[model samples]
Target chain A: MNDRNRIPIIITIMVILLIMVIGFTSQQRERLTPVEKWIGDFFMPFQRIVSQGYYGVEDQIRTLIRSSEIKQENEMLKEELHHYQSELIEAKLNREELMELKNLQQTLNSIDRSGFSEPITANVIANNSGNWFQMFTVDAGERKGVGVNSVVIGSGGLIGRVYETGNTWAKVISIIDNSSSVSFRVLRDGDLQGIVSGSVDNELSGYLFDPDAEIIVGDQLITSGIGLYPRGILIGGITDISTSADQLLQNIEVEPAVNFNRMNKVMIINPKIYEE
Target chain B: MRRLFLGSLFFFSMIIESTFLSYLPFPSLVPNTTMILVICFALYYEEKNGAIIGFTAGLIKDMIVGRVVGISALTFMLIGFLVGYYNRKVFVENATTPFVLTAASTILHESIAFVAVFLMGYPIHVTMALNRIYLYQTIYNALVAVPIYFIMNQILHSHFLKKSY
Candidate 1:
């Protein structure tokens, strides 16, 4: 290309870049536009194929890593199995009795039952190519009854909440993001309530309602049914606790139960009208 | 017709980057394929075409990512233009140009993205972005450019191969 042609091209490229920058900057950052949604829906099939491919590769890697450990675990499990065989009958009878007692308790505190409902399983399709485990896309969307604000959980516990929905896909904001906060309470002491918030380092820290609350290390935390997340979902275990002399709240730190690095499949809670 | 093919290639690369790339053990280690392609095309073709391809690819990426729409587009266009323009000045048909150009473009592209993302009101850690995105991706993308350059060169030169008489 000659100088004359090059000049025009450079000018055109700069003009387009400027326009796009201005246009995009002015748009809302929180919501996807119609065109963006259509583009995402268009790529849904490709997303599924890639998602499967990703999981297949991850499974192979996990298998390779666990190959040696599996042998030891197998030996351990077999020994434990023989021991449990003798106790299985007694445990079954105890479970039956416990079930009867639980039924009586449920009848009494039926209204205060933990806020948990069945979930809709979804495949994790894609993630933002960044070190921060903040955002990811799931294969279920409005078409499959997935809506924004639906709680998402993996095998371990609370992962995040669905923040954006397209026709065939929904974007999940993981609990590890800087913008995420969840209302939680101590599993051992239900009255000890607090709000756990995510930081840039993918750790959770928060403050308890009472500065005088005696929080101990290893205290398991669960959702308090205060926000979009349902009640009784395991958030994590408290790792550290501290309190300043003049502060009104105790500083608490929690290590999340779900490992964001290994997350592949998640279950999204469908819209259910819980009795308030 | 060739431009159309190149456009399709960029589009497919974006799809793979967004979907398949996420599954890699450390996804941040995966080279930015589209950015490498942009640099390769700019060096092989001309700066003008490179800028256009980069812009289109960036637009598609932004749309699929559902983030700020212009950040990638602007970053890609500028990187494409600078790489292409300097590629013409250097006019070196040697083996080192693609690697060097790819590295420079990757750093430029990622820096532009970091600035644009920050401007869009998203909190960014400067040192982390520089190390993870700029440095890591530049090295990875430069390495990726080697094979991609050879493959694209072969495809572009296929018509030039005469019959074995």
Candidate 2:
């Protein structure tokens, strides 16, 4: 570890570092080829293991929080017996809402009669660091009929689609993903078909190419039943519209009804099977 | 055997990071924890083996969630080498250097990722992206880095540096 030896080692390391940076930059500039895709698939298992461990930790925290809340409630009820009836009614309403959500899920499942008939339910595993697009991993995977391109829906509406799948886990690309694009139509006036695209920050928006297409800020957007996704699933609501003086199409912004960050339960829609 | 175990642990942690930890709702400007933790680890263990581990971890990460290929691997490798080289000379055995380095490295890692995306013909709004990167996420990553470093260091030490004690 003499100064002369250290200097040469540092210079060699710096040269190696320089070469690596150049190689990486060149690779990033290119499109993701089949080789890259294969590599991505190979690494998916590692992602799942990490996701599962964090989920386990979070699950314990959630259980502790719930149990503590329940204990507090039990103690409070001893002194405030009169309010018990109202609390009971509130609890019943909460139960009913939960049941309604379950029913909605079942209905969604029934409609999605793909070859892979089993339903996959996943918990919200994570969020992005500082970007608008929030992603999640579900416990369901190939073993449970989860696959890439499967649709995911939350309580609010169509959340996103499965982008990566492992044996026991899957990663969802939320609709807010900047690269995501879906063919959607206005529920009120089905005439307006436009491509909904995600912004850099997952602020959902799109461009309607048809100049005469009838659309407004309050209109609802639903999957157009074109391409990978099935028809009539709710996407989001139009939040704003901006028309440039010379532009042919109307620039639009949408606020996704589905709060992907808070979603605890999601149903993965198996890819549809077409009859010959 | 220890190297294998440590390698698997780091690999598993990256996966959890992309899948689940990425979904947590932080206040608008929090940086990603995984990027910071990985950077810190790369800096703390800058040996040839450490660089290899860092590169493997980055490669695994790139495959899982990143759009670009090789970027994370290259970045992690560089950070690992620098950190390792620095550690050998300056002796950052304490926690403060990790905290400061984690903060700086998180920013560097994100910038590189963002620049890579932008350079790939993607029409990115640079200002907005930078806002997310520097303001919220940098702060968040710095805060989370200490705990993650502590946990990861303990795991690495127990698994790989058993003879040191």
Candidate 3:
């Protein structure tokens, strides 16, 4: 084959491959086959090694750039911490009294115990590189008992859920992705439930189950334990509230508790599997 | 043999983009290394080799980070092939070819990806993607192209590329 004639042949091959790939991918969105899982597992170690080196250098650079701001922030945070510590001591005493009352009430009425389990810690290996969508890879999978739909929590609160997994690695879809939706209730008003879903922007949105439900700014939102997530995990705080012109539903915005920018590690909740 | 080397390079580039680049200051503004590599190869290497490299690179990318596979594969492969076709007309040896090509091809790649994702039922915010991703990536890629091109040029001239034509 002459050099001049090679371009057309290559283009033909590429077109065929493109069509085949697109067709194959469109059908396999949710999970990967065993072979695909094996491939991902094989490459996970290299990704981990690279991530460690990358993060080490990254932290150094960031520290140098933000030293002055950090100093000021450190002092402010110290004062805040002292104030919060005093409040926490008081809250602990109230919590103890509440637990005693709850135990007495439980003795009077038979209630099933909440089945929340311990979490498996995992190191994040990779984050979203191409699109505006929020997704990440964590270095835990079937080996560590991380499975599909496992809820992941970061420093402050809920981060996301494990979307797909191999033998040694898992992919997490952040709560901010357009497709992810979490059933939540206003922590202040336990009766009010809604579905918090991701949108095009950074913030998340949910509609009040009752259009008349009063949603105030700064209200805390927590998982309602209806579907995927366990009940009572802090999801975010309400940042905005509004009603459409027709007033069919009240639209609310939530700011997630986890700061994705600083998240390096997460915990995957492993629900106990009851044997059939 | 050369294809294997390029394939691994592409894979390594993927790892870097996902991990290293994400930590950079203003990480969102980091250049698209995969696009840069593809365009550089398309501009400098033979048309056929460029397309094959681009296809393999995109597939590796899709396997790792993509929510829906093959969207990036189609986008990058097409960009590689189109840029390669114009290689004959463009002066590959010119100092500024890579910078110019990188700038043009970034827009082309992002636009194609946007269209493909849109077709796949993704509700993309066109203006936001255009401003945040496409525009910033183009400028960043253009800036990074100078160093990447020179390094790649050196590597090619050292042994991998022989002046057979």
Candidate 4:
């Protein structure tokens, strides 16, 4: 009866369980586990507190060490003030001119969201720590109409798509994740299309469909409107481009428009744009 | 009580890496603190304890940040068991032991994880992942492990003090 050498049985069971969990999670797009949602929501407030403190400290440090930047900002503010003062005098002279100005501004803004609805804003509460996967949790979720596949954009350009959401928190898998890929074209030439993919280095690189596309460094890239992302979201500028080893496709490196490490706020594209 | 302490310690360490260090300006070099804890714990205790700690830490991570669960759990558990299995063979007091062990463990973990992910059909570029990402990660972990080892030794002086000498 001393044959109770049971360590192997336990290890085997664990291995089998792990494989099953992996299989289940990998195939799931959203609601992979209620456990994940509960844990994410439970710790969200704490993560928010930490992010706020970090933001406060960062603002202080930036103001302290950025005298040159502050001076530039001061100059810009002065210019803005002067411009506004002139606009005010002009407005006093002609009320109709002011209405025209308002219309022009609205028209320009409409182009940015012409096909989209008003975007919902969210705060990034937590980010993945190590350099493994590019992901984070935002404070807006299903309660705010944020659902899986909602496009997230920052001040720069396209951020990523929401892969999971809870009541008050949603998880975003950013475009810079190695597993994420986007179809894009050179904004300079719409015919020059390529696939921009993320890597473990947290960098963006892609390959062009045509080897002779005549693209160059510093050329802007935008979504080609072929995939989950809508057309015209600025991806980034090409930093380097060279032919692949086989020379069939042009390999290009990109610097994403948004700095993933320092992102604070993001906007989620509303799903109601098509219907309305 | 000891289990509670270790559990909370693992939780905090996990947060420090994923939340705090992640927000840092130069977070590229942030060490894997939870993995470090698992390695140290395995070294300080039995193989069974090591595997258990590793499994728990990895499971929590998967629940929090992992896209697919079990990848981290399997790799981290293996690391814990291997380290703990040979815990008594190496002198813990030697300043270089942690540096060496951490470096090796990180390499092993990254390689196994990379292969696992690739096999699972994620579109990762191999040369880029190995050259640009995991290399830096391994070096950074080894560097951080030195100071972390001394701190852990200080906290659990009684258990590991004799083993080091």
Candidate 4, B83-132: lDDT as tens digits: 87778565555877788888888988788677767777877767777764
Candidate 2: lDDT of B101? 72
Q: How far out, in Å, is residue A115 in model 2?
A: 11
TM-score of each: 0.78, 0.68, 0.83, 0.82
Q: What lDDT would each prediction earn against the true structure?
A: 0.76, 0.67, 0.78, 0.80
Q: Arrange candidates by lDDT, descending.
A: 4, 3, 1, 2
Off by over 4 Å in 1: A1-31, A57-68, A71-118, A131-133, A205-212, A240-253, A270-276, B1-4, B27-29, B160-165
User: What does candidate 4's lDDT look like per residue over A205-249, in tens digits?
Assistant: 999999988998999999998878888999999999899788799
- The candidate with the higher DockQ, 3 or 4, is 3
Candidate of highest lDDT:
4
Q: Grade the docking of candidate 4.
A: medium
DockQ by candidate, in order: 0.43, 0.31, 0.52, 0.50
Q: Which RMSD does model 1 reach against the true structure?
A: 5.4
Best by DockQ: 3
Query: What TM-score would candidate 2 get against the native?
Result: 0.68
> What lDDT does model 4 reach?
0.80
Model 4 chain A: lowest-lDDT 10 consecutive positions = A1-10
TM match of model 3 to true structure: 0.83
